[model samples]
Target: MQKQTGFASILLILLIGLALTTLVIGMVTSVRSLQDSSLTTHAQTQAQIKSAIGYQALTGLLKPLTATQIAQINNGVIKDNGSPAATIATYKVVTTTEGCPASTGGKNYFCYDITAKSGGASSVVRAIYTDITTGGGSFNGSIFAGGLQIGHTRNLQGDQTIQVGAAPGGENGVVKGNGSSTFYDDQAQFTLATGITVQEYTPTKFMTAEELRASANYIFYANGKCAKNNLYGASIYNTETEPVTCSSISGITVSGSGASKKWTIDAASSAIPVGVLWFEGEVDINLNSSRDLVNTIIATGDMKVITTNQSGAGKAYAPYHYYLEASTNAATKKTRICGSSSTGIPTQYCDTAGTLKALDTELAKIANILFLSNKNITFDVKSNSPMSLYGNIIGSGGAGGTGASSGKFTGNGTIDIKGNLSFTGEGLTVTNGTVNVKLNRGDSSGNVTPSKKVMTLSGLRYM
Candidate 1:
């Protein structure tokens, strides 16, 4: 009996000790788990704070930068010091959206997707930006000419001044470049030469076929009949000249046939018929021989301009044709006209307008442009001097506005102005002094040119 009682007590004591030990272990584990959760939460909070700080810092950093400064940033020049947490920040421009300009030096807009790290975690956001020049110092664009031979100037097109909200130039039109491209009196402007970077340009990045079709507000027909189109609502033409099965347009005149078609649009025309215009067939532009004029056209066909003789083609394409007062008072250079007497714009503004311009003097300062879209664009431009064109000239991948076909230069050609002028899937030949683009818009491109740029997070989604 004594042994049994002793054994029972010892067993009970052993069981109690085991229970206590198990309970203590359980409590310790629970406490440890809570602490672990708290630590994880704290770490996440720190990461979030760091990410937010980086985001805010980058956003502020890009703002207030000059157009040249922006270019430096894009080219990895790293001019400014980034935020402390973002010392390891790196970014690539994921997307760039280009918009038509009101003038040569207006804002060139673009958007980008960035992936950044602030040491703890990674975050992604979209940024929209725009770069604008005053005028007459740049032919802006990042061009990839297969056989580059330029002598004059070229400027890459600029992009939208996109903000957290809102939508997106011409004469008095300033062309915008995305900071990666430029033009010069390098191409023989054929005096037509611009840009040196050997980058293959994918036209779809600027405009896609579907996007092109969707962008048009009106359509014109072969029967000389026109109709209001897709996004033509709220148009000045809608109220003034509502054309449905209409006979003709007032301000626009068309002449010639095939690659020699001559199309003219004058602001002097009773009204500017369409906002964003598109044409099905190739276009011919009959430039004035005796006068310097300004015209705007956006087409999905071949853009044709009347070419002039070699001497005439060698003449500069002056942006100050209408503002003759400035052109004459400009640098000591002669006017774009084929003349020994006419004076061009002063070197202060026009000379710098050339793409890659370094503010030199003695070179004729005026520049012009020719734009081609993906759908089908033919610029049959015939002019006395180098032709200054506006709009896209050639598009590849059938992604944007127009197409390019084989043609002969019945006349000499010099191109002034700025914008996208990419060619592809064809024989590539270029020369120097033939094309020139100066994109200094501050004073020469447009005297009253206005500049505004905005950027912000388009969306914030966590991964």
Candidate 2:
């Protein structure tokens, strides 16, 4: 009986020991699982922190740089903090000469690949920027102006684009005057081209007067002479204060034809070393012959162009007859003021080899013909005669009035332009005539191009 009792006690003791061992093993497993979860959470938090740091570094690095400076940057790595940090994220910059996928053909742009890396993970960012002033010396559009107004029976036609507003904060528009005037694109009356965009009333500033003068090829006084003095006063035509007559000026040689003549300022002629010409007083360009201008003309005061004879009989004369002749070579080096009375000037007239060559050479060096005036741009037109002009026109004091006292771009006859126009002070008004424009892409091929020295941020991408 004693032996049986001993065996039962032994079995009970063994069972208790086994149960305690199982409980200890379960506790160990639970602790192990908890430790693993905690470690994973800590690692994830570190990674997130590192990523944030890397992004911050990239943003700070790119903020203040100009487009040129950004393009010049070399491939390299930058740390989040100073060199000897305990933990550091990194940003890598890589530049490519080619454009991004969405960039236009022939655009001057640079693409940057930026990679941010930390804690075994990375993010890639891309940016594309354009050179705004790439074609600084040239203009591709037909007409650019500050304020524009057209009257009844008038047509503003062209195959090129038209731009308005030389700089920000200036007034600009294509006035809705009874909706009688018409605009034509690419010889199709009342039509616009596929890719042609009219930037009407955009608030963007262009080059300043001082900036343009600094880029001048030649400086002259009134009456085609060199500048020799310095003076300043309120304009007789406007309220704006400007340099007095002949105080600061550029030079040009005026010759060829009747009272209406050609103004020449060839840099190769040794008289003017540069093709840009600046005049301190009024600039009077009389369109008398088929001539070529290879220089930009800037005037401080008013700029005026008028036909020598106002009577209908003058249209039958030599230069005036050629001016009205449909057969006259529009492509040659000539000043075509107005379209032919019978048929409007064909687009082919302005596409001559000689005219292109002369204009191209000038544009390659200085870009476009920049005609700047402090007061107004006056066009005196006769009845039944059309006036045509080629170049960029800027009136700083707005449009002069029809009266002898008002400073405005006022006219009583039809008008045409193959360039850009801008007015700072007032607006442009054309009464009883049409204003036509045939945009010029300031390049050797006469293709539409962008301005030089202007830059804008195009797009950003992330990978």
Candidate 3:
């Protein structure tokens, strides 16, 4: 009996020892599992932080440290606490030039590779660029480029192919290669042109007056008619407030049909020419004649002239003509003509009461009407020397009394008057130098009185 009790006691002791050993083993396993989990968490946190830094650099939201900005980013990112399992990383930026000049000159490109180093591993951010003209002429991208692993052997070497922007025929998502792709996740954070630069242009505001006055003899046209009339219709005005230098004219031609008159310029001889002409309502005819004669046409028009006391010297006047003194001229000075015949003023202002102009105002009105009427009237005149014509001449084969004072004329002919001539009209013109009888105004007075010459035309000689 005593031996049996002893065996049971020994077995109970062995069982207790076994149980304690098992418990100890389980606790050791639990502790090891917890340690492994903690290590994994720390590694993951480090990876996430590193990746976040890289992403921020790539997107440009966080600008690349301008030596100054970098210091700030680093100070904010890396804490001074001694809780890190690994040492803080250092960074270096590297640049590469492939098909570009060493220094960015015309069309030079660059790639920037930024690597952040640590004890165990390293992280890098890259960017490839084409815009070198923005930042002091150099490649200014992220830290990594060329898909090269940071602190790894798998990084690419040599010229890493880059892309510019979207090409014509490329994939929808991302095109690859230099011909297709515009964006690269490897060589650069962005694509780059083969070689390119940028520049800025600005204009200055300091010019001399002489530079502005370089242009002369400018012609300006306004409204429906011109301010001056040459042979062709009327000429534009030169309102430069100064004299305009122009070439000389020798002669001109005039011809046309209908109520319009055409005047053409002629360059046959050498002669001093008039500067400009003013046509109110007549068609101007420019003729290609050998002499300075421009042909014109006349229509049935009326003449109204008012005379002011033209001169102080006494002068004799006939029914239609006026005899001036040899020296005291009566027709070569200022004279005013009105529309009323019963006003008792001579057609030539023959009374020596004031100064009389050789050119008659009524005649000037008639000429302007014919030139601007744009009608047809055939007449020709030319001059090699300076001359003037006064009074009025009626055409159109109709008794002259009523005439249009304003109209347009068109043609290519000649009517040369070197000296000043007075022409007036409200609606009458010679068109293209064509003789048209429709423009004639018959005896408007309605009186069957005998025809009386109202005025005489002087300084008018035809060839």
Candidate 4:
């Protein structure tokens, strides 16, 4: 019996030993699996972090780069100091013309391929960016010129900003002039509240004088008459004396009385389909103040305005305002031009094609009269004639072309302007009576908004 009991004890000990061995193997397997998983998770985290760093570096360098410079960048590596690995992240820029949509006008888009590696593990990320213009050609300032001058009592309010190029025979590109007979900023008669902000002058790339003349929808010559008897009431003086004789004649609708005339021009119904009107030579305007609404007028020579004496409170309307490409000459006496009691005219009357829908909808469009010349812009404000201009005025030189002599802006008598006055000319001189100048916000683009260059990111991927 003792021997049998000893045998049973031995068997029990062996079984317990086997069970202990199995438990040890299972624990070892679990530990190995856990360690492998932890290593993989750590590598992935490092890779992700590195990838983020690379992406940041790429985006940081792209904002200020011009389109030409961006196109030249390829296979470029940008490093970040805060990277987790010993080596900084690597980046490659690939430009492709195939991917960009047709709407971008054949402009090339950019592809950024980024790679980051740590501990033999790597992560790759890709992003695509589309090129665009932020605000088109930079206007730089509200007024741009080679030289500037201002007259007495000339209130230049509402973001009175100006940019001047190098003057003729002046050092650097600094502007020179001011005051009654001078064109220097220091000698100007107006007081500088925040002071006149000056910037280096750059030629206007927004639109050129030659381009304006070439794109003129209506071309008028000297002694052209804007007769009220015909439909659309304007005729170019040619061989034909009829009101509708001109090939590009258009009509204007006018309303109101005295200094309160409202004008509307229809783009669709007019013989000249476009909004631009070009005057080739000196033209005279003899509108029976009762029937005329003017749009954009681009003059190549000189412009003169005269109203008939049969006045029963003459009314006029001009929505987008006028653009005088050359010089201007108007009646020195008080004559009612145009005015509006309403905030703005309806879009149906202003723009028929709806191309200027934003102008119609937002009412952000400013009614401005811009005189771009290399000569002089004269505004006659005589006594007993309260000449009041309801829009902004921009008198600039070099409207004829580059290297042209800067023009002059002169005003006389009781001249009342409800908007800003900006001049990039030889000087501005206002004499005789009180030259009342107020400020109003108007559209700078007339009524047309042209497309500009811009850059934006689109497709993104990871590898």
lDDT (Cα, tens digit) per residue for candidate 1, span 403-462 = 223211223344453333444423222322223333222223322111224443334544
Taking all chains together, the TM-score of candidate 1 against the true structure is 0.38
The global Cα lDDT (0 to 1) of model 1 is 0.37
Q: What TM-score would candidate 2 get against the native?
A: 0.42
- In the range 1-463, model 3's lDDT, one tens digit per residue, is 7658689789999999999999999999999999887776666556445644544443352332132332243212322247564333323332343222243443232333334433344454443333221111111111101111111111112222221222123223222332223433332332232111111111111111122121111111122222222111133222433232222223423344333433333323333122222222233233222322211222122111111121221111111112121232443322212112222222222222332223332221122111111222334322221111111222221111234222222222212211111112112222223211111111111101111111111111110
RMSD of each predicted structure:
16.0, 15.2, 36.7, 17.8
Worst 10 residues of 2 by lDDT: 230-239
Measured by C-alpha RMSD in angstroms, how accurate is candidate 2?
15.2
Deviation in angstroms for 362 in model 4? Answer: 16
lDDT of 2 at 409: 32
Best by TM-score: 2
Global local distance difference test of model 3: 0.26
lDDT of 3 at 401: 21
Q: CA lDDT of each candidate?
A: 0.37, 0.43, 0.26, 0.43
The window of 10 residues in a row where model 3 has the poorest summed lDDT is 141-150
Is candidate 3 or 4 superior in TM-score? 4
Better of 3 and 4 by lDDT: 4
- The candidates, ranked best first by lDDT, are 2, 4, 1, 3
Error of 1 at 229 (Å): 14
Residue-wise C-alpha lDDT for candidate 2, range 1-463, written one tens digit per residue: 7658688778999999999899999989999998877776666566555545555555556555555576566555545355574444444444353445443544556555555544445556665556544333434553334434434323344445655332222323343244333342222323343233455543334454444554443455334444321111121111122333332223345553333433533222222222345656556654433332333466666677554444331111112222323355664314332222222221111222112222222223323444566666676655454455544555655543333221233444545554455555544433334433233333333222123354455766665
**Which wins on TM-score, candidate 1 or candidate 3?**
1
Report the CA-based lDDT of candidate 2 relative to the real structure. Answer: 0.43
